[model samples]
Target: MKKTILILLLHSSLSWAQMQPFPLQEVKLTAGVFKNAQEVDLKYMLALNPDKLLAPYLIDSDLPLKAERYGNWESSGLDGHIGGHYLSALAMMYASTGNPEMKSRLEYMVSELARCQAKNGNGYVGGIPNGKVFWERIHKGDIDGSTFGLNNTWVPLYNIHKLFAGLRDAYQIAGNQEAKNILIGLGDWFLELIKPLSNEQVQQVLRTEHGGMNEVFADLYIITNESKYLAAAQRLSHQSILKPLLAKEDKLTGLHANTQIPKVIGFEKIAKLTNNADWSGAAQYFWQNVTQTRSVAFGGNSFREHFNPIDDFNKMLVSNQGPETCNSFNMLRLSMALFLDKNDVSYLDFYERTLYNHILSSQHPEKGGFVYFTPIRPNHYRVYSQPETSMWCCVGSGLENHTKYGELIYSHTHNDVFVNLFIPSELNWQEKGIQIIQNTNFPYINTTELVMKLPKNQSFSLNIRYPKWAESAKVTVNGKIQKINKKPSEYISLDRKWRNGDKISIEFGMKTRLEYLPDGSNWAAFVRGPIVLAAKTSTEDLRGLFADDSRMGHETKGKLFPINKAYALVDESGNYLSKLKPIDNLNFTLDSLHLQPFFDLHDARYQMYFQTFTKEEYEKQKDIQKQTEEALMALEARTVDKINCGEQQPEVDHNYIGEQSNSGYDEEQFWRNTRSFISYQLLNKDQRGTYIEISSLDDFKTENLEITINGISIEVFSNNSKTIRLKLPKAEQISLKIRVMSNYTTPRFTEIRIISNE
Candidate 1:
């Protein structure tokens, strides 16, 4: 009877999906690198104070506060965002490990949030600052939105989406009934809130970043089997993004990378629930485009949180900010959805690469802190978040990344079991009266063994994945090798599986190879099987290794080693792998440096990519590269403050306010143009800057423009040049404004830099 009830619950939770992952409670991690990561993440999660995370929800709901809100992002404009993520992390960890403390924390959070909902009396509860007022204005159809702000609030929809996701996880994964009730109430409130607004208004609101709102509503539909929730999910989908995707256009360049990935995940989810092949095809096209053209060898995409042009990764190669952790966090979700819905082994290949290279490398092994960015620039470092002082989006996602490593290790149907990842784990199939223990030290050693325990002889197929990176594989049952006929990216199935203590072993060999950048660039990365190989360069200047509670603390604000000075591979023949000498199975020696798996090399400056050139080409280009690097470094050194005009985070950080304004990307630059006015607050600390330089993608010679410094008119030094300089006012803080003087719109401004004349 107990097993029957459990099966019923599992069926109820996964009625809509074509393929289903086993419940977290039924899978357990054994002694391995991934298991260690899970333990480390649990420690980090416990270090965060639950009371502080709940402060925003309490204060906003007019309830008594138990603790002050944490600083950094939690107290800043994006208040209470991490609190939602914490609930999810807690619930997933509880389900994955069956830890009592995690369950207690999850229950506490759900109950507190329930109180907040009850106090609001309108079924609305959130951690967004002044959320009540913000929703009231949104409900009244007074909407003003930009790329990262709606009604002058920083991604309120994105912030609230975290809460919605957290509540769903609590109810579905942890079996918390109260959470389901609270989720229904919040979903109803959201439905009513948008009922009065037109579809156009909803689209305008969606211009800002909102994390997977449509996906959560679809999940609500699955939970309640209600048509209204399904309708809401369809209504909430962004038409602007959907239209271009359905047309199979690559309109993703220069867009925020993490923002779009979650929405695409929602697209796949809704597609499955409604059986819409068009939508599913669109999502699949997006996945192929991003994974094949835009991504680095490490399986992470974008630079500085935005998708760079696929043909040129030069900007990403030079910038200190590289692939963000949040992008990988969402991409993995999309990959899992597609892999399950399509039953494609190709998706699993990408998933395994990213899981080993990017996701596992994102967290500190011993420090128990989360990383926000994993810069690919040679010799550059990353900054980790301190539990008390950091609340970045990556931190929120990072909390969940390591906790659920057991999610895709094994999946099953009623009569078949699929072995997906090679991580050491055990699966309990209670309904079938079977237990499978999988043990491996993969990548370290290239073999995995599975021991099956069954009460009676049973006949079922065991499908083992054949990764694309492996050239050949051999499978042995008991003691004899079985005939192999499957190719790469196809499953090798054993037809008969039975009896207790039945053992199966799979062995494969990995070879070192070079993977060039997707843009066909000269830069190349070393890969062995699915693991990316990196070399530690130096540990001279790893500034802000651990973050403090500052707005940009998540970024590594350290001296950038000159790109020209970085180590390069120079050879006349195109045999880069010949340069690598094997020290062991996983370690190699290249010249004077030692290379190992990227996930194991931490707390030091490392190089994941190397510029490759022929001997003659290297001799000829070295001098020119040095000159360019010097000039770029000099410009960076002289800057006191800077802002990329049209990007989301940069503009929001500068307190941007505009009327009759719009932004776009053109000719490899992001720009903003205004017919009325656009203003920003910039800092010239210690009054060190002598001039402010404004750059535009388009020439400003034909337009009438009025520029002001702290509300005072300033003379532009040049009107014909693409860049104009103005004398800086003698103030620490300057309010700079650009106004259109004629009927024509202003030039497309790309960047504003406060230059020091010292």
Candidate 2:
């Protein structure tokens, strides 16, 4: 191809088709669609459960990657099987950048996957719960025992759902042709497998953790305009969460909120694409139920990945692990959809809230792994999994979290550009042949400038985001001011043009505010500009869960503690808010404020939110805490890092806080040590959007439940079950409920999973 012809083809085929405006005014890390995505999928993982049926297939099969053997070694790859996340991450990266290598690698993987299916002569693709026996059990109606267990994810058909979605995303978002075929075959296989099963039986399997198979399938159906995928999507829907959403009820507490959000999003997609207004209404209703009724101050909810009990989230503050990165991922997706379709500023409002605080804050300042949740209580630490080690759902989101730092910065109407986020990056809208660079160090510095380069005499409208946090927003061009209203929660547009180089800087003078979490506990968080401030304490001084090794370990080094005690408090007026600043010279810190980024404070413990404990309550718990501390120190002694500094590693997971490290240590360590919980402290702020975190439905699998409607043996599982299902006939007027059985006297459920055909 000649140079002129090649250049023409490149411009036509590549950047012209998709032009995304990055939020930050910086050159973000974006690889072309095919190049960066393939490397991420094929390079980043090291799976421990090689035969788990859902392991990342990128690593060598014999790579010392078994959960049973060498499970505790970081090299063991225990946390590597997250299909939904990885696929999505890969898809997003691929779509954002159209790299041919990425396209080729994705195609190769899909082709290999097709070959794997052909070899198995079954539609299945994964190594986990790795045998075909689970299918056999279901075939014979042997519900007591599963071919494979479900929590973390079930049949991992849920895991495969991720791959299916990834392939679909690659095709739709990035325009990959081969991805379409691979995903279609996978969906057909899923449809065929469930063909012989009744709703009850299928629901029984659904009882196990299945990542958003329905969401991706529904999305695929839309792309392909095929209803079988949609039907299969509906079949996989968990009625537990949807029934309430359909009824406009608020029963989201204690449920795996993120898992259900995507499903709700799938319904939203279906409702929109198929033009089912009822489904559309249900999705909107659910979004309202979860967002308005069940959200926390952080613009997130679902502690420990489930909905907590109604209005009683305080009981689980010490366990403040709600709003998984995955949940936020789903919420953002749903919010974006709502924004695009409805063009509602309200949706964008929530998007802005989470993007800056939760999502942007989720990434580790150093290692780049994303936190699973943005905790709301002090002392619970946040950590990230190792790149080669931790591959949890958060890891997948982590992959996506950083790659799209430029996303949503600029959205457009037919004529004007809408700027949303305040990241320091540039936007090249090639269609208009205009290059607009946003210049500013956001969250650190409160100002941003959008410098535009356009053809001489060309004119257009530029709408800048006058954030809700802005006290005064000004739009000025070339020393001559432009008239624009600084309306709260809406964009301020300036329509005028002409020139080689022009500048319009919207100085949204940031203000500081005290934010309150809604659990009724009194304490407030400091927010100056877009950054949330957290109190820091040292981890070297604390052991076990409070140490640097634990997932819930504190982020601070012994606090500037000895010295911080003096600077930690303020008087009647909020004078300390601006007075307390981050020291200007800390090379490692992002910004210096009285409070630090939730992900950075690895030295001393930090608190985003707090409560004043009664002196008596503190005294009474002294002995109990002592015992806990002793056990914790002992546990920490066992997890030392053998290589670096010859020091003990942090005990990061709450599941292993005071307990001995599990064999899944290395993978566990990636999540535990790298991750920490951040609490937002507010004393009696308004009680809106208080979120509830739920436990897993996997816990329900262990119970002996007899669920029957109309005398049909609706019994779905064995004794000591990992998951059980209760299928419902679709209707808006049926009054149906299940007698959930468990060996324990009472198992606390924080969330209610729902599936609906109504």
Candidate 3:
């Protein structure tokens, strides 16, 4: 046994990794009120209590919305995602909160799903239409799964992956006995499903998209003590993708970096769980490659939410479109696995960067919408979901996002609670009779105060995370400065007997700097302490393809065309508006284009890194391009908006009555199948400097109507309605506006034109 173990370690660095026995026993947190909120959150989800639509789910056997709204799942590929998420949410909620009801709900779901599978008369059961067929073809290896396909086609394995994952999490996290049984049966079914395919075919299918099935299956195998399950999980591995990562190759350019990384992560966990020394080393190698070599200043990968080529960082810097929030989320998950094995601070460092910059920023402030992509260019806007419509994978992760604030708040070994993420929250450890209250705004403010209350005196080391971003830090014990043994971005140890009412105060100083791309290009990115700095845009100068919904993707001309009114010119020193520090009396939005912490910039146009230039030099460059008809071939910038900094993008003139409900607004009128209607009251209106956009595409969807005063109908979407002519009566207060009624539902207003004869 010793010689065999020695050989395994010799083949890979994973010999250094923790080789724990099968079935990790559950551990209790020493002391804290941390688990309470997770319980409340998980219970709320299990209750199917939706706060957004203000509707409680009818406990009816058939989910009416699932049955009616997305019946048959014939075309839409989103059902499995929703169902998978719902199940995973239940599982995680149960595990984290230890709620019995959650476990019951999960068990119930497994039984219901099993019935559905039985009715299908095969080992196939997909909530969506034709998904079973997709899987069948996937088994045949006819299509590549990872290539972002169009139409009703997608990597079916990826979709089913969520369901399998949810089921597994139900067993592991929530301890649902039924879930385990169902998973074992399902695993058996999967073994038969792939038995007919050749190894090459299986490998090809694995190359496409499939969530962490390989990892989850490996876990299931361990629990069942079955080698077949392990073999199946190994077959699911995409050797092509894993080999490069394991070899420490930077072959990530032009790839769906985020989509692939999670699978590799699953592979990593699978390796660790199965005690594969090579697999574990390979997983770690891939993660380190991404963390040290492939990441941007924000600790994120991918330019357009996919990794560009390894050496082409210069190209990626300019084309940074959508950094996949899902990828970073998975990386953090991967980081935790590594931390558990090695207890290394480096893993936590990456975790901290991603948690603060990506995960925290992924949530929308107005609504708890999770983002799919985070745009790093000044002209691009951060888009978000409106809760129900946007439950992408990020949304699934989003459900888990805020609830586990305690996970990062504390990690325990034999004798310590290693505090990682700093947030304003509380932790109560019932077993230890210890309560810790952490209070502070955090990144917004550098000071975080931890107050620990103990029912009895106890001794333990409080390992506080000295984040990698902090240049220097100080610790104060009960208002007195204490000597910290570790450096910034390292763990500061405090081992002592703690009494009640002991307060620890920490001040971390984070500074900003410029980071250049790997290609030695002149392009650079900004980093303030551990947080990446982005150029904030006040408003978007939406060119074409601008939609009313902020969550919808905007189609712009390209990256070279700047968003008008959103940006300010920076000087040679990279200061806004030629070295203008925001005046104390100036508006908060003046810093609108100022450097923002990366995650605070959801749904706004921001430049995380910039192509710097001075006014004189930039003008000279522009002049050379203008004069040289045969110079650099053609100009890199678009003609419409080469540069429109420090000005508001011209608003598309909008028209509407002050009081629509009091006038002609009808609640009975249906929009988007909803009974909601406009509720504005008519009043005296001004039409100065107000402009309505007129472009060529308006000819087809035009609504030509004669102008009216109080009961007016004006042509809005007409190409012929040049100025959006509207008639406003000279009465005491006659409201004037153009109201759009969509043929489908919900009124679409282009511009609200108001004219007053004052």
* Best TM-score among the predictions, by candidate number: 1
Per-prediction TM-score: 0.96, 0.68, 0.69
Lowest summed lDDT over 10 consecutive residues: which window, candidate 2?
654-663
**Candidate order by lDDT, highest to lowest?**
1, 3, 2
What overall lDDT goes with each candidate model?
A: 0.89, 0.50, 0.55
The positional error of residue 741 in candidate 2, measured at the CA in angstroms, is 15
For model 2, state the Cα shift of residue 616 in Å.
Answer: 14
* Model 3 agreement with the true structure over 650-732: per-residue lDDT tens digits: 11011111212211111211111111222222333232212223222122233422233456554443345323333333443
For candidate 1, give the lDDT of residue 430.
82
Would you list the clashing residue pairs of candidate 1? Answer: none
lDDT score, candidate 2: 0.50
TM-score of 3: 0.69
User: What's the candidate order when arranged by decreasing TM-score?
Assistant: 1, 3, 2
